[model samples]
Target: MALRTFLLLLLLLAAALLITQAQGIGSSASDCCLKHSQKAIPSGVVTSYRLQGPESGCLLDAVVFTTKRNRKICASPTDGTIQKLMQHLDKKAKNDKNKKKGQTQRPRGRAKKQRRQQV
Candidate 1:
């Protein structure tokens, strides 16, 4: 009876380990796309996107677009519409970044005090 109980415990432990390992794998792939979407995605709804491949831990090459609501849609990279949309998004991002950099930076601390003294 003692030996049987030990064996049962060991088996249970192995099962637990397997389940945890499987869950770990699933979590790692949680952001991965299992398949690509065939339906046309409205460009207006896309807020951002990213590319995925086998090296990126995905089984297929895909351009994953993030919708305004933060939903991810995987699309084929070779699609002309997808490519155009990616370019548009890229340009928008670049423009946004440039706009941020163009913002006026005021003098701080000693600089501000020196400017006040000068005036």
Candidate 2:
């Protein structure tokens, strides 16, 4: 009986380890998994993200995002939604680029106006 119990415990442990590793918990996904990772959404493409992990895992409560930005910028499982963050960043980047271009180009504010309206 003792031997059988010991063997069972060993088997259980191995199974647990196998499960953890198979889920990519401590590997490359770990950097982005429970810890949060980002990628640029790129122009003309919608970004999508979701956390992957066990039910009791850190990502169980994670909120997925559908936005544009090829990478993850900042994330907090409790604070903000990922979609809002990406949209905010995309807006900021677009504004910044427009400002820079405006400074470079002739004061044809008319063209800038058109771009803003289209956006």
Instruction: Specify the poorest-scoring 10-residue window by lDDT in model 1.
Output: 107-116
| Best-performing candidate as measured by TM-score | 1
Tens-place lDDT digits, model 2, residues 1-119: 99999999999999999999887767644433344444433434444445444553544445445455554433444554455655665686788889997897667446543445554
lDDT of each: 0.87, 0.56
The Cα error of candidate 2 at residue 74, in Å, is 6.6
lDDT value, candidate 2, whole model: 0.56
lDDT of 1 by residue, 1-119 (tens): 99999999999999998998877664445688878899999879999999998787668889999999988999999999999999999999999998788776654457433444554
Clashes of each: 0, 10
User: Candidate 1: deviation at residue 61, Å?
Assistant: 1.1
What is candidate 1's CA lDDT for residue 42?
89
